[model samples]
Target: MQCSFRQLKEKSLSTEVTQMQWNPKMDLLALANTQGEVWLHRLNWQRVWTLSPPTGTTEGQGVTGLAWRPDGQVLGVGYQNGQVVLCDVEKAEVLHTSTLSHPVSCMTWQEAEDKHRVTSAPVHVDQSSSPVSSQATPQDTAADFLPRLTPLPKGYSATDKANSEEEIVEDNKRLSSQTRLNILVVGDEAGSIYLLAYGLFSMGQLAPEEHPQAKGGRLLSVTLSSDLQCLSAVVQHQASADTSQPEHTICLTTYNTSLLATRSQELATLAMKYGQVATILGYMENTLRSMSEAWEDILLEMDNKLAKFAETIDNKDPDWQVSDEFLQLLMWGKASPELQSFLLNTLTEKGLKKLGLSIDNSYSNIEKLVLNHLQRAGQALLFHLSELKGLSLWYDKYGMLGLNTQAVQEAWSCAGSFMLKTNELLQ
Candidate 1:
């Protein structure tokens, strides 16, 4: 089909749209609005599903990006506060939600080739007639690679004997089979892209082989040079519009990891065996830390601004004026207990009442607001806390906690306490 772009709606209810994605089958479209809202529309532009923010999101956090899984079974929406919400497309139910430090700017999926092939340990077939011939036919080349098949044992059943012959012939044909294409590429905002292959298994695990040497022979080659897949990562340089033409041009950056660049296919194979799980765990943990730090930074910045405002207001000349920026900063987060007391001390009973900043009388109101904002912070925190809890549960259930005992235990302890505290405070 020809490529076409159509506008389903002239104006989106939310002013800012940060990301958009179409399903793999191109039958559905998803839009992330800056108002912490996601809308799923059918291909012909019919509104279908609308996902709302979990209640109690802070003022600034908003929807930032969206991605669809390869099979179009799931939709993942990212938020400015570094949260990810995953939805099941068919049921329209939210399945998983996560938070990262930096915002999730992008997501992509990678699929890899099935490199496992049936093999036969070839035995030199004697060509007594015209053995000196130089040129080789296609069948001759195939025969050279084919394994010397052994006849069925006397006790073998008819079905087993018949299947063994068929499998041997299939192996012989595959020895000289043409090359096939099966690979998927995925890229991320962390300046990295990965290639992955699926369905890789050992031939010994598949149909049986007939050669006498098959006992020690590996049905599939483990050496990546001739066997596994390859992967590559290329960086790109972003240039200003003034220095470049209006036409779209991508400047490829020099690769820092030749291991992935030169042997990406092999890397993909190894990734499935043991490395990918570690990489994914690292990605999840690193992202969660980054999101936590971002919230911490925001709170710290607000605290610093409030401190500077209080100092200036106290030391400045009686006629000096306070800036709106200072007041705005002061209005954010759980008002520091110390700052609340300071505001109460600096203002008169009437002035404090007017500003609604009296610590003694505002205790009830302050607690209410604190609970609200804490709930907001908790919404993000809980996302990570639950993920940690889930990981811990998996580790305990599967008995895989031994690999990273210290880290996993620490995570369980900290997150468990955090979840308890948050629930307590919220209540």
Candidate 2:
């Protein structure tokens, strides 16, 4: 059979294109070039945005692979320099970065079916699981009761980016909640493959050299089947063991990934809960950081006042008990000469009251942030982590997924400790 092909559109670029992938859910195309730069283009070949390699990277370190996240929202660009960067599709801003011990070879991203479209009964989607061990029901979903966090002021709010706000919002609506279970797989030349859950969390790594199939071969590329039942890898083996002039042979290898397909729904819900955990963690961090910055200013003011008082007291307190003198003043409404001079002259009544009020207000703000935001966020985080730990309890099912029950329990306990610490701070 013969088929005729026609090129619809083409564009010339100064750099040679080394790799390209069409977005599965959109008309956008992501291209990596010899210059180690990644570029996005519209359906008509109109240039969208360009992403340069990391600073200080050598010019010879070109892009190795480019994979679009399942929803076509984030693009994963791998480089010969052993770095992988997940970039937002809209403005080419980086979302996350990871490094590999070996240079990257190829990458692929896949997602399980959407969970919201499933007609399961509504479980508390916020906290979907528990280690006490209940099978995932059809209704298992994230039941986030936590308040929606205010979006942080973003760094890339350019005028050109305004046109894609709706698309970006839609992408976030899909990704922020983790409605679909997705994985980003990156293979390196050292016969090692790395996996990222939702393109953000490290899931696990596969060292093919440990397996017989790899017998002294380097990985060339890797792919996951559409149904998530199997993973395929291409390896190049040295047919002749001559170090200076070796003959190479390519081979195909496959691994069973059926659990990924069978447990897709439950894992999707697990990811949803984990997403909740991440969101709450971020909110708590921001709230605590702001409170800390505010307290820093108050600390400086207090330090200034304390410095003067300390200088005055240094000359007077050789053997005197200042605590006893302060207690005597409190009961009798009169202070000794040195103490009276410091209180009435150095610190006037109005000035002392103002200082106390300032400190009180700062403490009040800290209490509000802790009680209203930080503590609650920690609780929400614990709820989600407990659900994740519950998933770990199904050892037969989740064991291969590389989630350690002990690790999950440790994370849960840490969240609890964080909540207690916040309460203690307020007190």
Candidate 3:
């Protein structure tokens, strides 16, 4: 494929660009500058919208990283003050903000593969059970194995349960052909890596998990595999006192995305479940609060106006009759009854039913989310226990190889303790 590039004139931006990212599924590009400004631009170089950081102490911090969610609905901008803000580009509104301990240096967004295909697809081989085969036939490729997971029987062991749960969690992270679970991975100058559950972030909550620290360095870039199982980072380490030049290091990290996804999925699910209730109550609370404040303001204004009117009366003004009527209406709280009646009459049977349907749909979605979360939790727990068993087996093998097993054993013990704690929490 042939590609072309276009240069934007300096007039297009007020300051030099610090970072920029093209939307994965759109012709748009998001740019951030040294002055802490973010702008969206079309591929044709047309300016779209400009966004400034929320006004506060961190407003002066520079923009450090930019990432677009897979669906291209929101842009994630990281700042030098270690704050990440998700913005709805079209609306020019802030969706969510998350803070880190150090300046954000790099970021990457990724989606997992489809779970159904990964779990059900047959294993491909060169030939049907051939030890040495140079070519594979279509029939050989069609050979199948059992699905990645099977339904657990009643009374399964804890290990079996943990193993099954882990698999399910992993499977849940995979993206389907049409759907996506957008994940945001951010790295900072402090050598800390953060994984954000994008769905939760969009919901105004920061669901983040940290990875093992890297060697001291400023992170240059971060990337994730399509499967979401592996992460790679580029770090630029400062030179030591004895050296005249700086050195760069490449750090490759592996993680069970499924486990992280499981945690994030659970959080999103729970938030949705409780958020419905909070939403209804919050709307009512805000409405009443605003109404009360408005009334207070009106009363205060009226008191001052009335005091002035009394002085005008003492000065023998003839306009006091009109002012008296207005004050009487205001004090009676009976202004515009016709408007209230009109609004009440507007609530017809059809309108009422439509409102009911909307509420029901919200509840239905929350129910489904909760059920899915519970089922996945069980599966993930089972998978985790199975993994622990496998680790123990590997530890035995390492012992046979005459490797020092004390550290391994201690690690295993710690893991076991964690599992026990988790189980206790569940119970």
Candidate 4:
């Protein structure tokens, strides 16, 4: 679960790696550096294709943040000039550019759309089984259900006014929307997260107001370390209620490998519209199943990937070799109480199969074979019995193959005769 970023390859890009954005669709990484130079690097182990800057010139622009549009055509670059530039990766051209309020710290797409109005037709619940009062009962109208406030007290103090003002402050609340926009999030050295809704084409033809550079996203101060190394934000996944097209979720990671964020809150909100309680539980269960399966599949794929990587590198490379830590992570941990109960209830069946023995007759046959081997090896079949003679009642408790004294004694007498013959052969 814990992994450190290993440097695969370092290119002496006229400047240090200021910001890097991995293409959403391809293995192309767009890098921007302090020298105001942007380079496109196609990442593959056997071959690396690099597209250098057309002309090396320090335009006094320091690449602070980099982002790739969802469709993979345009790359969003944030610079020290407080400008957000959309660059075409294939043609190596800048498509669109705009300046922001503050020096661009962080930029990302706004995954959630504000839904101020309801569209779908409402379903009326039957009054008989519903928690609300029956229609037959005369009660206060639905207007009463609406949130109402009491009039302010006479001569309210300034402190009370300030407290009421602070209580109404809304923090980073976004409405739900079906339209998908490529989130370009940038975090600056000043520890501010700036999100920009870019790649306007992804949401189909957009009006001038919907343009990426024009419709900038909300700015919030997010949690970051003291050195301001990395910033991460959780985004909303696309809406899926409409059956025409499947929704998409994006995963964003920093160059330092510190933070990872997903855009899926809208999906969670959409699930609650039909029935909040039932939908939320189902969503949680499905999420757990997805996470468990994803980790399992990652380990399964790692087998082949590690093998191929190991073939090229020295076996001693810690990353190439499968570590015991990772192996333990792949193994199943302590079973739940319910699962443990089921296992114990069927212990004989499970244990027998695991040991490669049959439950019904094979186990008994194996036990008999062991006893016979001991008898044939001239081993004494000593029975520690109480001194009370004619203890016929005790024979059944010992499981001596008979309850009656005569049957028990007869079996032992025959076993004794067989032992003598076996001893003679040994002599």
lDDT measured at residue 44 in model 3 versus the true structure, 0 to 100: 78
For residues 1-427, what per-residue lDDT tens digits would candidate 2 score against the true structure? Answer: 2457766776788989999999988989888888788888889888899998888866537899889887788899888878888888877777667889888888989775443132222243334563212343345443445443333322211222333333321123235534456788888878887877676666667896556676667878788876678888888888765566558878898988876677665555555555455556656777778688657645655655545555666556576544555557658998778777877788888878876776677666666666655766676677678767777776765655666899999988888887788778877
Sorted on lDDT, best first, the list reads 2, 3, 1, 4
Which model scores highest in TM-score?
Answer: 2
Candidate 2 minimal-lDDT segment of 10 residues: 151-160
Candidate 3 residue-wise lDDT at 92: 69
Q: Residue by residue across 319-405, what tens digits does model 3's lDDT show?
A: 444334444655786534432343256445675465445444433433332233333333333333333234334433222322234
Of candidates 3 and 1, the better by TM-score: 3
Model 4, span 246-311: residue lDDT tens = 574433323231211221222122221212212222333333343344344444544433343334
For model 4 the local lDDT of residue 365 reads: 30
* lDDT string, candidate 1, 1-427, tens digits: 3558664566445457766888986589888776777888886678888888766767546765566655566676656565666676765776445554444444444332333221111112234523212221112222233233322222211223432544331221111221221222323333322222321211111111222222222221111122223322233334456886533333322223233233332222222322222322333344334435444444444444345445634444665333333345457644544456655565447754544432322333233323433333333333333333343344432124222445546754664575477567446
Highest lDDT among the candidates is held by which one? 2
lDDT measured at residue 273 in model 1 versus the true structure, 0 to 100: 24
TM-score of each: 0.33, 0.69, 0.50, 0.29
**How close to the true structure is residue 340 of candidate 3, measured as C-alpha lDDT?**
36
Candidate 1 accuracy as lDDT: 0.41
